[model samples]
Target: MDNDPQAQTLIARFNKMKEKYEEVERFGRYHPDYSTIMKEVRVSKREMDMHETIAAYKIKETELQSFLDEISQIVAYSVSDKIMVPMDGALFKDGGCGCGSGGGCGCQAS
Candidate 1:
């Protein structure tokens, strides 16, 4: 990993949060279940909705953490590769990014 302090802190936080989220999901999956019929169900509808909401949020958080992990990997590799470029050029368009054609900037205006 790169020696950058900010990157290290972010990666650590993301990893910790991701682990906690996984634990919650595992608990939900292992919880006991019961069959239901036209008579009635034990769990309240509102309680079920809340549980579903929490599960959805956990799923999204895990996905975002996975993306952050991939970015950290790329950054570490880039530092080792010694490949560098101007920040501005890497981010902003140079206005002539495309010409009168059907590709690039797609400015054919046909």
Candidate 2:
């Protein structure tokens, strides 16, 4: 299939969002007492909402990726079953299907 510009853009946006979420996670991890941090940083309700949005986006992206991987497998197999098996399919960029040969694209499941 041709490279999808929109999908690529979404992937990039998701990566950036994931990075920002990681920063938030680190902040929370380092300072368990978030009330003090929240007061110091003046974190508003909207800021919390933004974080939640980011998290929801991450979940959506993961589900989308998994769906894409499964669809790719079906398409490939439809073209030629021997060309791609279910054991060779993965939903993430780096994961194994536990098959001996590692023929999959290495996409981890969602």
lDDT tens digits, residue span 1-110, model 1: 25545444545555555555555556564533212211122233223324544446557876786677667658877788443322322223334324543234534322
For residue 74, give model 2's deviation from the true position in Å.
Answer: 0.9
TM-score of each: 0.29, 0.36
- Cα displacement (Å) at residue 110, model 2: 19
Name the runs in model 1 displaced over 4 angstroms.
1-50, 81-110
lDDT of 2 at 56: 71
- Model 2 vs. true fold: TM: 0.36
Q: List candidate 2 segments past 4 Å from native.
A: 1-50, 85-100, 103-110
Candidate 1 lDDT score at position 21: 51
Q: Which ten residues in a row have the lowest lDDT in candidate 1?
A: 33-42
Residue 91 lDDT in candidate 1: 23
- lDDT, model 1, position 104: 47
lDDT of each: 0.45, 0.54
